[model samples]
Every structure is written in structure tokens, then in C-alpha cells.
Target: MRPLDPRLLRYAAGARWFFAAGAVLAALQTVLTIAFAWSLSQAIVGVVEGRSLAELRTEILVFAGTTIARLVVTWASGSVSIRGAARVKSELRSRLYRAIGRLGPAWSAGRSSAGLTVLGTRGLDALDDYFGKYLPQLILTVIATPVIVAVMFWQDVLSGVFVVVTLPLIPVFMVLIGWATQSVQRQQWDTLSELSGNYLDVLGGLSTLKSFGRAERQLTRIRVVTERYRVATMKVLRTTFLSGFALELGASLSVALVAVGVGMRLVAGDIGFGPALFVLLLAPEAFLPLRNVGTNFHAAAEGVTASEDVFAILDEAADAADATATAVHPGGGPSSAATAPAGLEFHDVGVSYDGTTVLSGVSARFAPGRVGVLTGPSGSGKSSLISTLLGTVAHDGVLTLDGSPLPSGPGERPWLAWSGQRPGLISGTVADNVSLGEASVDPDRLTRALALAQLDGWDADRECGVAGSLLSGGQAQRVAVARAFYRALRPETRVLVLDEPSSALDHETERRLAASITELAAGGLVVIVASHRRRLRDIADVELALTPAVAKR
Candidate 1:
């Protein structure tokens, strides 16, 4: 997470070899460039001194061969490096996706679809520069530039030291410029991500807002946010272009100085024409890499910003590692009890987000085979309580499950199946949407669960449109319930949580859905629903009325 960390390299353990080989190729190319220039000078000077034609021919052949070798190595390195960088990007993207999948609500609640899409798409794309272009070029510049300058020094110290002294300025300015622009680039990326998230939310809910004549206002807000991001982006771009221009100007001036000095020495007869010409040809290659590093530094600025985002998402408190599994793995800890009586209990528990409290001090108990309903006015802490029990929210007090304090990690103790108050809609058959996260779901179980939610009537093979577009809100809610049913059908399923279970349903449908939920709970499943509707209170084994606070024990 440090600004200067070589994160992409650390993750690219397997592909570093290819990168190293690419660096070698770059060095070889630089060596060949010098060798070719050196050979040409020797041949010409030898001819001028009345050397044999056959010797001249030999030098020419050697120079030609080295040039050819340089080209071959350069070409092969491009191929190998591009493929290797692509491999790194692919693997990193996969890890990112899997990590996000595991993170679930922890990340999803805070991010937007467009933002995540960008993170997965162009955001991950910055790694290509890190590995393919910048890394290989940087390595070659470091390895070959000094050696070339040393050769120039041996040929003529004045020219060698001249380039050597001026050479570091490119990288020096790069560091300075990169440092100056780092914060700005980072801000630009963050603003872009925020814009992406907001845009997705706006588009997703545009229809609803339009029905209430709020679409114009939403668009205005989006434009304001986007313009702000644009200003930030323009500022970063200005700095980036300046860095590149400075590097280019500095390199050009250095090369010009080398050319003028070499020409003067050749005229003075102090250094022979042959060595002087060679220095002139090879001087730019020394500075080219440094200039390139500056260019690459700016080119990869977004990638650097994007990579920072990727790392934050990847490391955002990874699903609090399974404590028992970890404890048992290394030190051989206690065994997991079959009935540890690890039911969830909350006492004086409260939670909040962004400094605004969502849940206040609360006390509750969830026992196996019992049904619990949390009811309150809209914006009350019913849903937050469920999140507290699930450990998705930061809590102020104690929460225990099955007599053991609930593990603070996600997907750990008290395995829960949460059917969110707001269900996801996707393009597919009814069956597909109901079974998005499940692997190899049973058809019979699927049929039963669908029936429980009163969705048995819909044709299973019919297209639901994108996100069950063919279905009405009540129908989608029923399908979502069916999904909860499918998850609960698992033999290991212990706790099933629902939010607004009957929000989309009418009187009769709500009645049926309530009955279905009761049937599930009656069969030893721990069912918890957050609702304000009085209709579901009848079936709840226990009813909890939540407000701003619950008295501490």
C-alpha cells in the first residue's frame, strides 16, 4: 500500500523470468548499437589509413551480424514481454474478481457497479505498462546505459563524463515530476471511480426518478461531479505532459552537447575521426532510455493510481480470516463442536456508517429452529441489526451465536444465507436468477423452493429478460425468496435471514410468502426477517420491535 512499493512485481513471481530476459534483450540491443557504430568507425578509419580491403569487409560483416542479432533479440523480447505482461494482467484480474466475490457485502455495499466494472476493466489494464513497457525499459536503462557511457568514457572520457553527468537529470526530473504529479493523478482516479459509481446508480434508478420528474436534477448532479473529475484529470495531464517535455528537452540538449563536443575534438585532431563519430552515434541511446523512463513514468501514472485502487480493494480487511480454521491449522486448536450451541446473541449492540448511526444499543437472541422478526419504522435499525448479527457492520457491543461469541469475520461461524431486501435482477431464465451463487442445485429442491415462494406457475424455460425483466416486482421478490429457499435447502444451512420479505407482494401474496417462511423456520431453520408489515408478525416465533436503542443488559 506504500506509494513506492513494487506491488505488480511482488504479484508477478512466476513471470519475472520473462521480464529479466526482456531486460537482457534490451541490454543486448544497446550493446549492438555501440558495437555497430564502433565497427563502422574502425572500418572507415582503417580504410583511411590504407588498411586492406579484406579487413574492412570482415568488420562490415561483424557489424551487420551484430545488428541482425540486435533486431532478432528486440523482436523476440517484444513478443515475450507482451505475452508475459498480459499473463500478469490476467492473473491479477482473476485474483481481484475472486477476492471481490469473497468480500461480498463488505465491498459491495460501498461500491458501485460502474466503478467495479472500471476496476475490473480499464483499471486493471494499467499493469500492461508496469510489466511490459515500463519495467523492461527501466531495467534495460539501468543495466545498459551506464555500461554504454563507460564505453564512451573509455573511447573518450570527456564525452563519457559529459553524458554521465547529464544522464541522471532525466530520472531526477522524472522522480521530481512523478512525485509532484502523484497526488494529483491519484485524486483524478478516485474522482473517476466516484463518478462511475454514481453514474451506475443514477442510470439503474433513472426510470424511478423519471417517474417522479427528478431525472433532470440527477443529470445535473452527475454533470457537476463529472466536470469536477475532468478538471482534476486535466491538471494531471498538464503535469504529465510537462514531465515528458522536460525529459525530452533535457535529453535533446545533452545529445546536442555530446555532438558538438565530439565534433570539436575530431576537428582538433586530439581524438581521431573514427572514435569521435562512434561517440556521436551512441550518445543518444544512453539518454533515450532515461527520457523513456520519464515518459513511461507519466504513461503509467493512471495504472499506478489504478493499481493503488486494486490493492486497496484486494486488501480491504480480507473476509476476516476464518479464525478456527487458522487456529487449528498451525497450532492444532480445539475441535469444532457439532452443536456448539453457537447461536447468535446481541446485547447493547449498535452500528453506524459514515458517522451516522444506523443501529443503537440492542439486545436479541436467535436460537436454532426458531423464527425471529425485527419490525420497526422505515430507517429504523432492523436491517442494521441483521448486519450486526452477520458482522458486516462495526458493532458497539457483544454479539454471540450458539452460545459462543460470534466470530468477527465474514462467512465464518454461524453460516448465514441472507436474501437481501433489494434483490438482484439478471438476464436469464427464472431458474438461473434463483441459483446464481449456488453450485449444482437440485431441481427437486429448486422446484419446492420456487413453489414455496409461489413461482411454480412461471415457465422455467422462459427468458426472464435481463435481470428477470419479464417478471413483475412481486414476481422478482418471489424469485429472490426462492433463492433464499434454495440456499436454506442445503443440509448445512443453519441461519436464513431476509429483509423486506413481503415488500413487493400484495395481501394474498404476502400471506402466502409469510406461510412459506414459517414452514421453513418450523423445520429447524433459524429464520430472521426485518420487516415493518404487521402481517408477518403472526408467523414469527418471536417479534422484536427496534427503535434508536435497545436497553443494555
Candidate 2:
């Protein structure tokens, strides 16, 4: 990716204002720097010519005032740039998170959780250096470099010509060095992602490894991955140092050439002391921004790599959503919702994984005030069918509401609630997770939902440590049930689907959960459950028995 990809600006806010303000500040600072140098040079010449201290008072005051003003301008510029960059980062992170959520199980199945975690956290944080340092300096370089050179030319054309001619060397060296190291930097990013993924996976499966007496074996694998990542990181750092050295060398040589020209002209009595010193001071300033850019490019490179990955995910999600929408609405018109009496219907429904059909030609009907229990063998695609209804995965055949095809987009299924086989819980209070992403929380409704999920005696304010580690497995499962019931508070939600909600419970608890399902259905909600427990199936108003694709054929 380029240092400033257009897609970043499209998603990030306040970039235009940040860059514009940076340019204005750079111009002001450049003018002040030149004036301070001119004043100092004049003061020195005046003092040497037997002038009194009082005679140079004006020059001294000018120098001090410009110095203070320059400092203030720089501080203000940095403050604005930082806030703008933060705003952009925050907005981009939120958008990426929402896009991932919309992609659902399809994305989860295809992506590495550790890789995505790194990209969202440490990867996005890399932009700090890119914005706080590189971007501001980049603007300064563009504005200050040429203007300073032009002023030096006005003072003494020969010295100005030398600076103008040699100044291009810094950027030229930077471009060459950057071109050579781009591939190495990309490799470093990939290595970091791989290492992060491996470490997370190992940590998650550590208990299993211990049980099988393979923990020691996995240690060696972890060490090898870490060493590889360390080597890749070192290579990136070495490249950065080499590039910085080359830029420094080119800039130093250019400044030295300008100094030599100015000194010779001074010796020949062609230029006065004040103008000579001014030209000399301004010569180095010309290359400073470009040099800084090369130095900060290392940070910029990491951010760019991460950004490429982030944008790729966003783009792919959008394409998938578009395709799903097209499939849902084949006539290129909005899909009509099936009317109330029929509730939800599936006709000749099928699902496939890795090109093999999991479920085929399955038909079922679910109506209001009824509970539909989906029962089948282990590989019969029971969960797959529920995921399709919940809009987590795409499906073949027609799923309709009142004989009208269901809408394709994930957001269009707001009226549907799902509690997956694995309960989704984060580290927060019971109420927090129950009301996750909700705009408001109702105490009475919350209490009722908890009761319905069999979560009695649990405090709403109790902390559910990371993934509900603070709660027992059954308690966590009940919390998932509570979350689904809370979502069912919406008047539009006519269908509730629970996938293996009884998996973590005892037989008695499973009976209680089944009773809750029957109660919700009695209250006029269409409840669909995919479960192996007969206790749950016994309460069903309708039972759909599915078979594997081969058996059906």
C-alpha cells in the first residue's frame, strides 16, 4: 500500500482539516525561523562593529518574540493533528468492528481470531507514529523546503542555487531506500500476525495439551515461532536504520556543499556577514523535514501494512453482503416478508460446506405461538439450518416469511434472535452483557428475562469475567439465554432460535430450560431450537427431523 492510500481518507474523518492546518503552521514556522536567524546574524555583526548593547536591543527582542511565537505555533499544530488522528482512528476501528459483526459466522469461519485481534488493537495503534510524526513532517517538508530555498536564493543566488540543486538528493535517497525495503517490511508484518495467531491458539488449547502430555512438545513450537518473529522484526529494524543512514548522508552532503559555496563567497567579499549566516542556517532547515520523513517511514510502513489487511476485510465483507442481497432478491426488488399466519417457512432448503451438501430439500413451517424443535443426527445440518435462518450463513433454496422471501442483509433480520451453541459473553456485569449494544435498559424487563432463563439469585451488577469465567458453564449458558430473551423484548422479533442451549446443563436444568422455551412459545413467540435433548423436543408444537444429504437423496 502507498503511504497515503485514498481508501484510508474515505473512511477516516478530519484528515482534510488536519493536513490543512499542518500546512498553515508549517508556513508560519518557516517564516519565523528565517526571521529569527536573520535577526541573530544582524545582532552578531552589529556587536562586532563596536555597537552598544542598546543598539542591538531591537534585534534581541525580535529574536526572543519570534522564538516564543514559533514554540506556541508548533504546540498548537501538534495538538490539532493529534486530536484529528485520534478521531480518525476511533471511527475506523468502530467501522471495522461493525463490518466484522455483519459478516457473522462466514467471517469467523474464514478468519483467524488472533490475527483480527492484533489488527484491531496493536496494528491500528501503529498509526500513532504515522499521524503524530510522519504526516505533520510530510506537510512541513512540502511547504517549508521549497520556500526556505527560495528565500536563500533571494539572499544570494549562488548559495540558493547550490541548495536548490542538492536538496533533491534527500528525497531521491529516501525513495530508493523505501522501494528496496517495502517487501521486507511486509514480511515483518506477516510474521507478527502469524506469531500472534499461533500463540493465541496454543494458549486456548493449553489444557488439552496438558491432558495429552503434549504441553512440553508445544513449548518447542512456540519457541520456534517466537524466534522466527524476532528475526523478522530485527530485519525490519535494520532496514529502517540503513534507510535513515542513507538519508542522513545525502542531507549532510547537500548541507556541506551549500556551506562550502557560502563560505567561498564570503571570502571573496561577494556577500555580507548577515546574509551569509542566514543562508547557512537556512541550508540545513531545507533538508530537515525530508530527513525526518525517512526516519518516521518505518512506523508508517507498519501502519500501511495493517491498513491494507483491514481494508481487504472491509471490501470482502461488502462484496459478500452484496452477493447475498442479490441472491435474496433475485428480481432486483425488495424481498417481501411473509404475512403473519404462516410466520416463517422454508422450502427445499439446503446448505453445503466445502462443496458438499450438508442438508438438502428440507421443508418446515413455524408459526406464532408455537415451538419448532429441529432434531437430527450429528451431521444432519440442524445447526446449519438454524444459522441460515439467523442470517449467519448463506443458504440455498427458499426461506420465506408468509411465502415471501426473507431479506438478504444481516441488519434486515432484526426481528430474529439467536443464541448460538457457544454463548457469547464478554467481561462485564450481567446487565451489561444482557443489554449489550442496546440503547436503553429496563429493570423490570431485565429481571423477567433473567427469570425466564433460570438465572435466579444472580446479581445484575455481578461481574462476568472475561467470557464469563466468573460464572459456571451452566450459568454462562443461562446468561446467553437471558441475552436472547432481552433481545426478544423488541415487538418486531417474532422468531427466537437457540442452538444447543441445553448442552452445558444437567438433565434437571435442561428440563427447566425446556419449560422456559415452552412458556415463551405459549406467549405467542415462534421459538426454534436445535438440540439433541429429548426434554426440549418433548415440548415442541412441531418437530422437523432432518437427514444428511446422502440419506435424503
Error of 2 at 103 (Å): 2.2
> Model 1 lDDT vs. the true structure?
0.76
Instruction: Please give, for residues 113-229, the per-residue lDDT of candidate 1 as tens digits.
Output: 788889889887876776556766777787778888988998899999899788877767877887778888888888988898888888889899999998898878889899999
Model 2, position 42: C-alpha lDDT score:
84
Q: Which residue segments of model 2 deviate by more than 4 Å?
A: 48-57, 321-341, 347-363, 395-399, 402-405, 412-414, 428-451, 454-465, 549-553
With a 3 Å backbone cut-off (N, CA, C), the pairs that clash in candidate 2 are: 338-401, 338-402, 339-402
TM-score of each: 0.84, 0.88
Q: Please give, for residues 1-553, the per-residue lDDT of candidate 2 as tens digits.
A: 4657777777776677777788889889888988888888888889878898899999999989988998998898889777877877787788789888778876578778888999998888888778888888888888888888889889889988888788777778778878866888788888888889888988999999899998899778888888988888888888998898888898899999988888998999988988998888888888898899888888788887887888887787778878876764222221355333467877777776657778777777899889999998998888889877867776777777765677644666777877988878999899999988878888888998898898877799999999999999989999998999888867888889998898999998888878888888887788999988889889988999887775422
> What's the C-alpha lDDT at position 199 in model 2?
88
lDDT for model 2 comes to: 0.83
- Candidate 2 TM-score, true structure as reference: 0.88
Point out where model 1 deviates above 4 Å.
Answer: 1-4, 11-19, 50-53, 94-113, 179-198, 212-243, 315-344, 347-349, 354-363, 389-391, 396-406, 412-414, 550-553
